[model samples]
Target: MLTNYHTLKNLIIQIKPKLIHSQIVEAFTQEKDTLHIIIAGEEASALELNATGQGYIFLRPKFERARKNSLDIFPEIFGDEIRDVLIHKADRIIEILLSSGLKLIFQFFTGKVNFFLLNQKNEIIASFKNPKDNIGKIFESEKKDSNYDLMLSDFNAFKDVWESNKIENPVLRFVKSVDTIDMLTAREILHRAGELEAGRIWKALVDVGAELENPKPRIYYEGSFPRYFSIIELTHINLRKIEFDDINEAIRKFVIETRVSKSYRDEKKTIETKLNELVEKRKRTIEKVIEEIENNQRAQQYEVYGSILMANLNLIEKGLEEVELVNMFSEKGEKIKIKLDPSLSPVENAQMYFEKAKKTKASLKIAQERLERLKFEIKQLENLLDELALCENFDALKKFKEKNLEELKKFGIVKDKLVAKVGGKFKRFIVDGGFEVWVGKDAKSNELLTFKFSDKEDLWFHARGTSGAHVVLKTGKRQPSKKAIEQAGSIAAYFSQARTSRLVPVVVTKRKYVRKPRGAPEGTVAVEREEVIMVEPKLPSEEIE
Candidate 1:
């Protein structure tokens, strides 16, 4: 609750904050919409103030260490030192004149709590709600009222004032006559007196005064959450009461316990949830890329089948359903059964097979490019998530966000930036010929190895006609030896689906011939000017020097 006239009067007397000229070390926000000030010296204490309709001003036992950011306006006003603290008579404004001849007015006037710092000339210097922005007019001074004179315990003194007042409404008249009494305080007294009539009003007023003198500050909680705070014990027995010896503590407890803190916690949760979803999505994309790679490899077989059909066309006849032909491509002239369309002639059937092969080649190139891009995106996201997890406070989180805005934007965490960072170092190995070879553990790394990391002079290898890692051999000064090429081929073959095969065909070529087509996925690439070498699939043992 805001310091009503009575409460403010009592606090001024209790605190007795004078012009000791102590230092104002820091001013910042821990909870959202709350300003905290640390005053050091003889009166070394922290002040917490909030002005968002339910605003309250109170002293906290300990400073909120988890400050999100330092207040830009506070430093300009106080200059790290305070000269004097004065409360206007019967007004809820704290006038703090700094050592620098600047005046800071903290007005707790029941709306948004606003701070105005004025120069010696009384001109606005800087403010939380800067006057230059035209948000609202800042007053030079608050209008003060006559201080309440009657002693709190004296019932006869209140009786004389009530009798003299001509106002009709008991509550309204009580508030107008007395400087210190607030609406809630008046209602509380009336409720306790069990009557709204003038006769019972005196008794209620006396009770309220006595309660205010020895305030038993309590916070009322509904369903295990704090709802409101009161100076006296509340009448609601159904609600739980948490008692505090100090009124400031009670107010601090109520302010800290809010939905705003919960929302910040929820925001952290949302970021984590989004990170997990991105990781899962990357995994699915990798799987799809692998499947596409395998399909394209099988499509390569279509080209071989078409060639065999064309060669044996002389023996083929129209209306023939099927034929057995010799496979010239194989080591042995292996007999293969080829299905034929009875309606089409031999030449037409051969042309159809060639057309089918051409489409598969085009699709393979596109899928490879798409696979490469997805892998790159996934790597960047993983790095971004690592940075996110390190953020302990909102300030740190905000800084991280500022630094990695583009990365977060790609994953839909922030606004869309439509950009990406692709590729990173992959696992490396050295062959007997002293050539360093890189092996990709995942789709993204594979794309990096083939298209980004390796130079045009370097060699590239992958398992022929199958899904495998894209391996890069760095031949800096000399051409890679036969042993090095074979070893690299083995590494590629071992990483492929044909790892179990005793002998697997691996396609090896220079990096210049490895091309990433537009819109291809991660780990998919088109190889040209390639030479196929058959080797037993196995992983390289020696680490790169």
Candidate 2:
């Protein structure tokens, strides 16, 4: 309703005489796409030019500029302003003629709203949206003939314009196609006329102008929220109305209320998007952790295999890939085939399986701890979604945001790069028995992985006697099984100089036993006690299992 020409014409007529020779002290933007200009004359007044597509302009008696986050703008026409502020014919474009051969034009046309400062030659000096092509060009307002102007007070002309247009609503025929008659004016005219007959519409159209001449400004509200404000009295939608003698005052209050409501809606949508992404990410983590826990449960089976290999070491010979033996624990007298390292003696192979079983048991505790933490995080995110539904006001949303800021940041919602940096310092993977395998990327990082990043008890691996990235099985106060070490070794072999080789020997040792010699080359480390595992050069993703 405020965008309608009749309302704008009345508003210009009311404020033009008041701003005669008023000094524009300041003009700037303090909010997103909202412009403010301060004026000092008989009374202090301000103009809020909300060029956020709605193009709502309000003249206010009192408006305090915010102390922070406000930028001063449009300094080109910031001095004295004349009272000759007029709307362009019947269009919503307001042209304010300055005494110093400059003009400030605010176009409030449909779809596109713009502000331009023009020099004496009507060339654009500056614009609000920074239209690069429009800056040096001669400004031109649209010059389409209005249906309202062509058909006013004539029944046949009104009927001809109304009949030629095919539309659903009779009110929209005037509001959408016609320029002079807006939705409010059209609805009020139809409501006053009582029907859609051409004779009645012509009479109402002629009579509506008289009503606009002496408008009783009103702001309509559904419940406590303002929905619409109009100069001419609206009889279309029934709602609570507050009448005002000053039109600008009513418009100011209504715009502020609706704009804040819109902000609240946009904020809720942002939070919901953040929460949805977080829940999906946490659920994925839970799936990975659960798979690790299931792998950890295989520790007992590894112990049984180690015991069987130790009992049958005398029967097993060296240089064998596998040995089939009767399972002592099986009631069906099942024979189990156990894989062996051909390079190791039978006793050493048995000891290696025992070591694997011990580490797998140790890794279970760490996996269980991680599983619990991930579960709690996912449940907390889901509950936060429920809590968000009750947020009604800006203060409630602000409090919700503040309360969950730390939790949201922990799950990649805020400061995402920082969260990823803390958790993803190395190329990491979860191998068998829930052990985390951390791989170095370069020569310098290889030294850090063995010395600075790894704990003393953590197992370290590298492709033996070849330039390679260091791989660390993050023991985390636990031992990792041979399967975990093998997977980590595979990752280390894949990133090394032996990557093209069919088989590579990866040396495994505790970080405590691995040390850099004095004045050693980068990534050159001497191992006091290390065991070598022979495997094909492959990454965990490339492995069959």
Candidate 3:
């Protein structure tokens, strides 16, 4: 669900080395039972190991730079502890760590091997399995460039070397391949293997064959020295079988949630700042207006406008303020908390302050209303931005932009420019077979198309009781077919706002009976003795050019 990069980064920071190892083991392991192994000691020291549920095992040879002294058998070199571990789980782990929050690491002993698990913010949430081997040789050979390759090669060779040894589970075999692990690789393998359920690790191997056959499967190697290695762990068989619809749905949900959070944060800040500024400005303006009104010598001449007060009065007593030299009231039935000029008469002060208060209150209300509208617009714009950012394909983005432009035009947010000269224009539409239809964009257009451009024998169609574009069907000296009539009716309905309305009524008559209404709105017309047709909305895809 975490879409932001910062959130995922925090989660990775909180991951513990042991849990990373456990995750790797769990991913590769199919066994439900616990594992037992020894670390930094012989097999007789048998350590009880818990199953990590998912994991992988990797092996590497012990080697060092040449020294002047003769080489001697070093038993102590074989007992170093494993150092690096990589875990894979839901992306949530990465999200939490990247958020700069706390995380908990859990560690325990199965027998001789140590086990560890990690949770966000250091809170103990779950337990994980332990590794079967100490991985000391692999951990100590960190300086070599070919360490990762050696590890994988060693793991693959493990089967041959340990063939005579008693190993019961197939999971152990797959675990040998784990040099490194990550969410994508884990998910790819587990999902294709159909191992989301508790049991079914072998199914993963079927696809592994297909992976090995691939000429260039994706591979990942550690970026640093003492490098670890991992392949993409996916096969062509899996790619062909895997469906991404569910993944796409998850991505969409994450995008929406992110947008909502951002919108809320932005709106909150804007509303608070704007509202505070408006309140302060209103208070100051009201005081200035009251001073001017009280000092005016011709205040009495404005009695009809509203009572001008010379002295301070409660808002309830002063009532509404009138706009200067206008009939409109400004005092919105509210009290003013401003200091009154003490030099003026009570009645004069009351009238002047009341009027000022009224104006201020009205101005404040207008400001608030405008702010609300702007906020709504901002929210819509934010959603559009989010959609643009989240759209995965270029085609979808183009369609979205086009839809937004159309909506803006419909709402009068954009001005329509006269891009072309006014002249005769006609559109010919062929519908459902060979029946040709024509339509006009305006009244003059209608007259030109129907009376002049179209033949008298052709059928004419228009929306009933509504001023809309005129449609003409050119039958060309032949009776119009039912398909042609239906097609024309659809056009008539679509041109009007009632296109989506059920059973839209359309009028059909001979081209001769239709007449443009003189001095009426563009596209308005009167038809006498026309047949009515009620039809659902739909038009043929094919149109006559």
Best by lDDT: 2
User: What lDDT tens digits, residue by residue, belong to model 2 across residues 183-247?
Assistant: 76788888988987777877887777677789878888875567888887788879999999987
Candidate 1 lDDT over 1-545, as tens digits, reads 44675555555455545324667777776556677777676656877777577466777554546645444336764445665677886667778777777777777776646777676777666666545662244456556555454534455676677678898886787777677677667667667777656557766666666777778777777654566667775563458888887665566677677454455457767887897798788689779877987787656666777888788789899998887888888898788887778898887777777777787786676567556656776777788778878876566677987898655653567743211232235766757544667888789878866776777988889998888788888776577779789989988898899999999999998999989877888778887799999998975544532
Query: Per-model C-alpha lDDT, please?
Result: 0.71, 0.79, 0.43
Model 2 Cα shift for residue 149 (angstroms)? 7.9
Q: lDDT of model 1 at residue 276? A: 76
Alpha-carbon deviation at 144 in model 1, angstroms: 2.6
Q: Write the per-residue lDDT of candidate 3 for residues 1-545, one digit (tens) a residue.
A: 12112122222333233222221111111234332222322212222223232221212111232345322221221333433322223211221121122221212111222232223334333223333343221221122231223333444443343343344443443333333223344455555656433223334533443443331222221211111112224442222221222222223233334345445445444433543454455456556545544445333333432342332234323333332222223455443233334555446655664576565554444344444434554555455555555543334544664677533332223332311121227665656434657778777787677666766677888888776778888775667668668978988887776777877899898877877677876555677779989976555443433
lDDT of 1 at 368: 75
Query: Clashing residue pairs, candidate 2?
Result: none
Error of 1 at 86 (Å): 2.9
* The best candidate in terms of TM-score: 2
lDDT of 2: 0.79
Per-prediction TM-score: 0.47, 0.68, 0.24
- lDDT for 373 in candidate 3 is 38
